[model samples]
Target: MQSDIDPRSLIGRKAFDRDGTKIGTVDEVYLDDATGEPEWAAVRTGLFGRDAFVPLAPSRVEGDALNVPFERALIRNAPDLGVGGHISPEQELQLYRHYGLPLPGPAPDAPGSGEAPGSSGSAA
Candidate 1:
């Protein structure tokens, strides 16, 4: 989450929840298409578990672990946006709502341009 930390290096690291519960391993890092900043991380819950997307803004890296400030169940139940490409604006909003995180930037339906917040595309 810190500017000094490389997003690419986050892959494969272990992630923990607020109560120090082991969630899973970081499977991928999603970068903001507009700012090119690290925005989300897809964690592999288990061998058969699907990858869950976690916000990177509030998450921090300590040593080799990624400390996520949310409950393990919340993280595990995140919307299945799937991995390996950009996260569309609509999908991003669903994630924000699911986490109860305040929406960033302008309102999604703001007039003027057709594109909404995070409409550019996410890089994983």
Candidate 2:
């Protein structure tokens, strides 16, 4: 996500999957409570379709569209956390797990380690 772009601008923009498959239009933008950064977008898949949340970090905005680096089927099947209001930490963690993406915060097992639990803290 472009840091300069206003999160509100993402609303209503068309979103596409990795292979250019049309997924939906962004209905809402979820921001990180800690950093105020754009975190996820709830996209309405179709007319009367349920909103699906897509992470904003790995997604990009091109023209009037959002390009999500994920498969259409996977995104469409994401956990239905509903739209509006706040997303609790537990819900956020679930979203990360659903997308197989890294957690934004430090590893819980090793506080301040800034690395996932099985990492050696050295370059491979």
Candidate 3:
């Protein structure tokens, strides 16, 4: 998985949005409890600079930076998961919901069920 990586490798890397807007720097990485894989990144953001967690699923490390497919406002507006603490499943769910990301795991239907969120499957 692209999300699986040495969390240490991400610290201090610049984070940008899909539109190439610089959001902030990576402050910390949160690991998934079930798999011990890098799941979210705590980014230092905003004028005063508070840490906000952003999902790493669709994110990619490019050169010296990480690019997340989310706007700065969206990450800033996500639930305040805090800069420290072991994120509980409940808290994780809240974060996912706030970001409109689906809960991790298999889809409820087949791939052709039109359940995918960001795809047209194939051009008609």
Best by lDDT: 1
| TM-score against truth, every candidate | 0.89, 0.84, 0.79
Ranking, lDDT, top scorer first: 1, 2, 3
What would the per-residue lDDT of candidate 1 be over residues 1-124, giving only the tens digit for each residue? 7988888899999999999999999999988876678889999999999999999999999999999999999999999988988898889999888899887774466563455665435555
Candidate 2, position 75, lDDT: 96
* Pairs in steric clash, model 1: none
lDDT values of the candidates?
Answer: 0.87, 0.81, 0.75
Clashing pairs in 3: none
**Greater-lDDT candidate between 1 and 3:** 1
- TM-score, structure 2 vs. true: 0.84
Worst 10 residues of 3 by lDDT: 115-124
lDDT of 3 by residue, 1-124 (tens): 2744577899889999888999999988877643467878888986697888888888999888899998888988888867666776667777888888876663466454443232211100
Residue 76 in model 2: shift from native, Å?
0.7
The number of the candidate with the highest TM-score is 1
lDDT of 2 by residue, 6-40 (tens): 98898889999999999999988877654577888
For TM-score, candidate 2 versus 3, the one ahead is 2
